[model samples]
Target: MARPDSQLLPLGDFKPSDEWQTHVNAIFYGIKGPEIHHHFQTYVSRDYRLAHALADTFLEEVRKQRLADDTITIQEWGVGNGNLAARFLSRLKSVDAAVYSHIHYTLCDYSEEILNGVRVNPNLQEHEGRYFLKQVNAETQDDFEPHSVHKIISNEIWDDLATSVLLQNNGMLYEEFLQPLLQRNIPNVPWESFVEQFAGKDLDALKKNPPFLEQIVWERSFQRIDISDWPYGTFILKHLDRLADEIPIPINTGAFQTLERAKQLLAENNLGYTSFDYGMLSDHELNLPGRPYYKLYGGQYTSMVNFPLIAEVGKAIGFADVQLEHQHDFVGRNLSENVLSALELVQVHPRISRMEPWDADLLMLQTLQALNASYRSPYKGQMDYPPMPGTPKKQRKQITELARNLSATGVPDTVAYITESEVAESTGRLKKLGYGERDLKNAFDRSTQPIAFGHMTLR
Candidate 1:
């Protein structure tokens, strides 16, 4: 977890652990078989206002347009589980009757399994012919007709798209090329069946010219990223000649490509689109502490969007208005104030918390984040629990004594040396101390302040 400039250990110092991400994620995401959504659920927010926000904005555009035959075509890109589509369609029906009646709402996804869920959904089923299911790849959007759709929207999807891991060293950029290491001559070989899909291609050689995965021109290895190729090349060099510092960036080329494709697919008459993804608004936050800009979730790769680039690209593509804002601000402006106030009240009050399962999960995550900041390594008491302000003193004393025992008896070495069994034992002790399931989880959970949601619109 050291900074980019920490040290150097010649080339090919250490090969990375076997992982499936980026374009390789296609293997796991039902491109071969079994849709990814069947196992991995990303649509945790069903009844939330952000879902309504996207639908509401789409409706706004629908209302603004001059209708010819009193109809409009709206499509959603990368429709995973179709919860958002069902939710949005239901919300649209309740909000605007005029737009909902003449709407051709299409759910676009690459996986037939995913689109099947959309077809069976009770909420979407109510819409009937108005709702069409289209199996299309977001990368090429091959099935879609340009200037045929009125509005396009995606939620938490751009990150799931193909991305390029990059690095900056000595004022130049390089792409991180990943080579999947497969076990050879081993019992119950991992990915044996999947690797068999590629005819006449060695696993090692596939790293350079992958059939499914993407690899840039020049590759350099450091930590998990390999950065050697610079797409900008002489262009970037000329620009850097007038600049001060060369910022290290993990560019999401796939997202940029998607945006460019969206521009083509959108109608020429004030085509409107909204993309809501968790990303960084500035380069300064790229390498900051407590910032997980890039993360691996459920074996799929996701990276923080360089939102400014989206806006600039949108402007270049003749978008009359391109705006980027935090999700909190966008949601606040569109949603009722009472909803946010109620959430804040619940956070401050000790009474009943009406948060859903996802909210509770968020709370525990916040607590653990705070705990990380409070205590350093070698302290075995570094466990996740409820905040002290909310818990009673008796329970607090029990936790303190448990911490003392862990610090004394547990590994006297660093955090890395701490065993999984030791941590599990500490968790068991917390349960015995009479802390409820939710309370135990709340100990270190701080508010989601550091976690900022990025919202961008192209119109």
Candidate 2:
């Protein structure tokens, strides 16, 4: 639904300053800095499944280590308001008390203000002495010594980092740099010029003036960029090698750097790291493309990760094993049988209303969690109003309602492969991971509510 405002006038008059990361950094790390919770709350939902997967990854690592430090340490990059941390800690507690007690969860974010804001979260608060709030950069673990942490996890952090927006026309490549349309939000041409243009018009008006926008005007800046010169030209050839079509994909340079940093930050052979971002896992997936969707929202920018590239970079970083899979596959692999069974039941009554059609599966999973926990179906009287020990009121209402219309004969056949979008790959990647097609489908149906999402992990 969103596209750049760049008008295609002849490339004749275009200026040169190809720097998408700068404006992106300026907006996210500067202007609205560390105000990440605000961005996610408006655009995405709380992903409980993802948090569970992350916790499971770390917990498994801790168990394998057998408490080397007697305390496991993990530093999550870009913890924002720490809702994910709260959910992770809560789930970790429920699954294993010993693991939960030993976790030294470090909430890292570059914004100190946001770091301070997360300290008060009741979910994170319950796990007292098990948390640390630190202001740090995801791309650089300069503060920590090598092999200092057990796991490095970031959800959607890579997309926020700087990226190069390149374009391919004919055999040549061009970079898309940004220059703020100073006139769009500025009263005059530029800030300094604005005051001169307005002169002495009410000095007090400046204080209550309409908020300024850090709106970026995308300009094709091809100056001094000769792709035919050695590494620069080699970069073009590198992308050319990967091109299914001559689409200019974003070179997610930040993801490469981040992985490099993560490799260094990880314990020698401990849980490497896991980063979940909406991305493409294979160049074949990029076979049809207008450069996978990137969006600009509220002055913040996000683009689908190039997972295959990330994996390749991980390999280049000397990581022996790099795995890339769909988000559902990653989260589904760790899902309990109860949650999986509940996933199947939701679709049994396929007509259930969900706030987001895509999230129908997850919403259903959340709604039926009581059933998963208590071993009761919606039709059972126990899962009702003024609910018994296992069934809470929320589960009673939602589950009871489903039970009324439920029919054993109507359960959906979820195993058949379903490509959620025109561009989604049709291959059964999860099947290779030892998952049943139907259950994989259910997991995908529940979680792929957001746009195309992929998971990349290296250990």
TM-scores, all models, native as reference: 0.62, 0.66
Cα lDDT for residue 151, candidate 2: 80
Instruction: Identify the leading candidate in terms of lDDT.
Output: 2
lDDT of 2 by residue, 1-459 (tens): 423333222212333232444334433544343454443341112335567677787777677867645667887887766767877888888999877887888888876556666777666788789988887777655888888887887877777776665556666666655444433343433455444322332323432445343334444444324556532345445755767545546667677778888888888756778887776566665555554546665556676576766676677777889977776565556754223323333443434443344335334434333222222211112211122235655665664565444332221112111123210232243233233446444543444222456767787
Candidate 1's displacement at residue 443, Å, is: 15
The 10 consecutive residues of candidate 2 with the worst lDDT sum are 376-385
CA error at residue 234 for candidate 2, angstroms: 5.4
Writing each residue's lDDT as its tens digit, candidate 1 over 160-237 gives: 776555455565554455544322322122334334542233333333322232211112354433232443333334
- Off-target runs (Cα >4 Å) in candidate 2 are 1-18, 29-38, 42-45, 182-190, 193-209, 214-236, 336-451
lDDT accuracy of residue 359 in candidate 1: 40
Estimate the Cα RMSD of every predicted model relative to the unseen true structure: 13.7, 10.8
Give every collision pair in model 2.
227-233, 415-438
